[model samples]
Target: MNIHKFFANDEIATRPLHHVMRAGIFLSLIIIIFISMSGRPLAQTIEYDLKSVSVLKINLPVSQAVTIVLSDAVSKIVAANAEIADAQPITDKSIYLVGRSFGTTTVNLYSESGAPVGLLAVEVGVNSADISRSIRAALPRSDVKVNTVNGRVQLSGSVNDAYSMEKVLEIVAQYGSPSIVNVITLKGGQ
Candidate 1:
């Protein structure tokens, strides 16, 4: 067969190939447009209430676990520092944060469809038992109670005098926590 005749005869086959290519291009463009208009930003950082214990908080050594309740089902969790902390999914709406080291890290929670649920600012600190013991040893009979809330050292109960209250605060400050709530009341107006 002549080369020119062969090319002419195959023209119908080439037309279908062109049409398929155009369809593929159109589908790709539609997908791109749909993704861009999905309302999910390329770079999203959801800010939650750091002060709320329900959001994110943990203590070192895993003595106690912080449970986070999610509004939606969680399919995956990404810890910024695995050595500092670890997150385990208890269920679709609940997760347990276990502290590994004394440091701060961020935990990213994602949905089953890979949409971000929220970002947790996890602060892993020294164990609350150690902190409480240290405070008691420093101020004996001071009636001070140390508790950890959202990675913050909370000093509650009553103190006998201003000196004792100051000493309790000083001891808690040594831990270098990000926040300290001194809720101790002085007796005798001292």
Candidate 2:
């Protein structure tokens, strides 16, 4: 092996290959730790589906409609639960998701050839502002906060105890089919 190639200078070349490998590995570990502690997201959100990402996420409030323009010509659309949300085609490539009630459901779209095109996760919720206002009043003592982020209830912050947490969740459940992005932290038992 040409050991000189691995070293930048004659002095570094004096180190054995195993020692050099260990140093390189240790440096990599430090770099990784630094990056993770930097408070920036090292990786970006995965573009789940380039074809479906643009149009398939439906975050409609109750008594509202959201128009989705699909890249493919939609021949047929089926909703898993029509009572919660329904789809009406606006065009061959577009549709309106009518929020029928409070809940979460999925709608499958098909192309003209009857091949499945995309699956849309439909969430029908009460207005976020209204839900937030009611939640604050209902739970006056806790530090938890629930927000409808990307059509799902991202429940964060901390509660006094597990019972308080459950009560917060129960209150929030009435608003919609909450996804509950679990991120509660502090909990001291009495």
* Each candidate's clash count: 0, 0
Candidate 1 Cα deviation (angstroms), residue 120: 1.2
lDDT for each residue of candidate 2 in 87-130, tens digit (9 for 90 to 100): 88878777777888867899988877888778888777756666
Residue 169 displacement (Å), model 2? 8.8
Q: How far is candidate 2 from the true structure (C-alpha RMSD, Å)?
A: 12.1
For residues 24-92, write the lDDT of model 1, one tens digit per residue. 899999999998899764332232342343354334433346666666677889998877778787787
- Evaluate residue 95 in candidate 2 and report its C-alpha lDDT on the 0 to 100 scale: 74
The TM-score values for the models, in the order shown, are 0.43, 0.49
What would you estimate as the lDDT of candidate 1? Answer: 0.69
Among the numbered candidates, top TM-score falls to 2
